[model samples]
Target: MSPFSLPSKPLHLALLGLLLFLLPFAILRERSYVTIDDNLDTEISIPYLLTRYHVALDYRPTAVVPPVMNGLPRNAMRSGLSVTVAVFALLEPLPAYLVHQALVRVLALLGMYALLRAHFLKRDNDKALAAGLALAWAVLPVYSMYGMSVLGQPWLLLAFLNLRQGRSRWTDWALIAGFPLWSFFVFVGPFVLVALAGLLLWDWQQGRGISKRVLLGMALLTILYLVVEYPLLYSLLIAKQFVPHRVEFDLGKLGPQTLAAQLKSAFLYFVTGHYHASRFFRGAAVLAVGAAFLLTPAAKRRAVLRQVLPLLVALAVVALFCGFAQQITDSLQRVIPPLRTFNLSRFHFLTPLLWFVVLVLSLRWLTSRKLQAAFIALQLLIGLGMNAEWLNNLRELAGRPLPDEPNYQAYVAPSLFADIQRYTMENAGPPALYRVACLGFPPSVAQLNSFYTLDSYQNNYPLAYKHEFRPLIAGELAKNAALRTYFDDWGNRCYLFSAELGRNFRVSARQHQQVQDWAFDAAAFQRLGGRYVLSAVQLQAPARSGLQLRGVFSARTAYWRVYLYEVVPSSSPKPGAAVGQKLPEISKFGLLVCKNG
Candidate 1:
């Protein structure tokens, strides 16, 4: 048997290809530069914290993760029922991450292969094409922390299509039931349900009756989501524990303002896609799909349009909505209460699957095997080129590491934080005794090191806490307009903002950046139980800022030079205002009382 023969053992070939594609991430391990944007800085910490604190299954209304934002609600983190959370629970952070990534990619490969083989490309000779496309789809640079939300769409669609045709069995039902446990509802669920509804409507419009199985599948999927994401649903609907900062989310201020900018954003979203949902240059796919549609014979052109046009239109509509969402949301918020806080712009999540489906359809028209192979190769190249993980590995392999981008080991700096933690314990007390805030870096770093942080980067938290925390950064915000807008309009990242540093979080030791005119509120910092300020950069005029430098610490492999600054004591300190003293009863603002407080 030929080693590369598709018909004899297609699954083996696909698995081998996937293994090769993921080998760099596996081999590099902690040295690999994974995505840092919404990934390392935010999502990676959630699973780790959830498992570390043994709160993955904790459902108490007041359950909190003390390491984050003083005491962030446990529900505010990712769902405890998530497969990724379970993986984190079973293994260490890096190994668990690798295992989770491998699992997600394997699922993507199998799901796409099964979907294409069963529905899209069923001919005996089409196995190679299906396998190739499946492999390409699997290798797209998707955030694996999200599990199957983006990459699992093909499998999901396959299930739905089977139900619609009355060919679904136990396995299809299992897919529908199991999807919610692994995937996030807020990110992709609602949009997918809406798409399914649209599909049902289209079928009904075409004189086809409603498929009860499809309806059952939808209900099952929703029920599973509600069950898995019970904590999130409870926090939002039932408990209403706290008014989230999302309530004040000003889309108009946050997104593109003018028509031209909106159009440009829409065009970019259509062609390049969004970073959260598999971003890659789509010029090849777009051109091929367009050419195929145009070059089709008149007799079969209508049939082809029927297959491809809706997907094309859906992609355009999603892109335009994402671009103009701020305006649309602002106009609609007055009438639609849910639209005020809930982001309707996430409809673009559907575009990734839509674009790939269009690719599959377009490729079906090409009779020449060489032409199909060429287009597939071009797409694979584009996907890899855009993948940060892959590109960073290539750079590492070529001995060219980007100074700004640090690998997992350097970014996390476990040893450095361990040293700092030990020093803090010896000088002050246990980390649990006092809250610390971060400067020039995300609080997630401190949180990962088991530090109880006063500040954090959370998608949702109490609005009252936001107000309470604002005074600390008020001096800096007053000086900087952009910082003020970022906090006041969309205060997800309730960090100690500095006008001097702006929004650059990853300030390396090599930069030697210093806050010269430090406009920090030390009194407010003391009030919030902030015993120490862990800064990546030095505050040149520490006395002016009412801060006394305690120590300077660095690790050989760490990227940061942490300057530990203790809040200067007031001449007449208030009762319970001393360092390590318990904070006041501010936690009762929205039934979110901090356990440590």
Candidate 2:
């Protein structure tokens, strides 16, 4: 039976929804801050353009350089996802972010459904279980919060769905072609491409042809996407690729042990996220694969498994090899920086895919009672482990009281997250420009820490971190080295919201001195380890002309305030009035600029 043909199963849908709700609730209840890392930068840019300049998504944000500017790579102005949202925004002046996030969630659901229906169509019990598992995968609350901002995964899955159904139409073909364009934008493009290759090859083995029409459809989609997104993508690519490169190193020193450790870390991260969802499911899959392995005449099974598993194996090997060999990895990264773009830890998502293959084969083996029982037992054990891990992590996060030290317990000022959301909402009343000056060094807010900003969270809300803005504090920090410090120093104890009163929002000289002396020196930051890096910046200033004057921001932060200073002659700092204070009553989205400053 085709997956879509399955009768509507109300029970399965309910279970899926429940799983999603629980995941995010658990994450919110446990983790203090929303650690949305990499994509936040994109998020910030889109919203800022929408509000600051009347720049439609079709038009790049005026605050940024156009890709066409001075023969610059077009990607300098926007991102692939940005182009997608911008097009949507132009058609209707709606909040592209909320729409983007919703689209991702929906695509994730559709992808999960297609995957289950493809693999488990005949057995109602298995189908239901697989569907439930898919839902769990889609609604991982932590992933959802991250997804809340624009990212590449949604379209990635959407493209996969197109592949599964087979390109029956031109639109289907268009989307499939467009999938890889994001590969360069978000670092996950290579993995998705590999997955696409595996799927196509799997189909070919099942007696499908490599049709010209399909290839044409793919080509058409690429042209269409490029016409839309090329400007921004091109810019980003070139900027990071100039000769006499800013980052040059040898991968020769990266040894076998480093590769092994990276492999272990990747495996653990994947297991943790998919613990309950993948464990039992993966064990079942492995058994099915094993059965398929045993049943096929040795040679035939070897051929089929080789075709499917090789891609998975190759990707894993590369990730590990790069982790181990800096010279090779570095050389490759310089050529195709996608290798360096993502959190190598995120490569763990590959484990579940590998297990899925195993589970499919194992399910085929479940023809016998003994095999079934063994699979079931394995599933239960994995499920138990996942449940235990979730409980433990939650307990650890909750057990800690409000931090007495600044670094230990710095929550976002009240309504900050909400205010940003409100400001970004479509046609929400009042065009109040807000400039948030994050005081305490939260993982998501800190510029230097990799883990804190892995998925580009700050950018999602339209926050900008220029090259000059990042502290050379540590001279030259390797990406992995930076990531290690972020996790070690902050852990998951960062705050998204806090219960503290508004009056306490003032900055201290001691905090300022610490930020300047210790945090300012990137290399010296470790000595101030576990200490707060108090920094501040605002988004808007009082209008010199009208109530809604354009907003300008400087990169410099002093003491606890992000001083709203005007640029002066000769590179000398011109002091501007302090337009606003972070009073408790102020909305997170509302930056107060005193009328007569």
Best by TM-score: 1
Q: Compare the candidates by lDDT and give the number of the best one.
A: 1
User: lDDT by residue for model 1 over 1-597, one digit each (tens)?
Assistant: 111124337667878998998898787888887788888888888999988998999988778776776667787777899899999999988888889999999889888888888888888788788788888889998999999999988878988999999876878888899899889898899999999999999999999989999999999999999999898788767777666778788778888888999999999999988989899888767877776767777788788788888888888889999999888998998888667788888887788888888998998987778888888888888887888888887787677989898888889899999998998899778987788999998888888888988898888887777888999999999999989999998888899888989989889989999888878888777667777899999999988878889989998889899999887765225765554445434333334532222
Which 10-residue window of candidate 2 scores lowest in summed lDDT? Answer: 588-597
Please list the residue runs of candidate 2 whose C-alpha ends up more than 4 Å from where it truly belongs after superposition: 1-7, 14-33, 36-62, 65-106, 119-126, 140-142, 145-171, 174-184, 194-209, 234-322, 325-327, 333-351, 368-410, 415-597
Candidate 1 shows a clash count of: 0
Q: Backbone collision count in every prediction?
A: 0, 56
lDDT of each: 0.84, 0.36
Query: Using Cα atoms with residue i matched to residue i, what is each candidate's TM-score against the true structure?
Result: 0.95, 0.53
Worst lDDT 10-window in candidate 1: 588-597
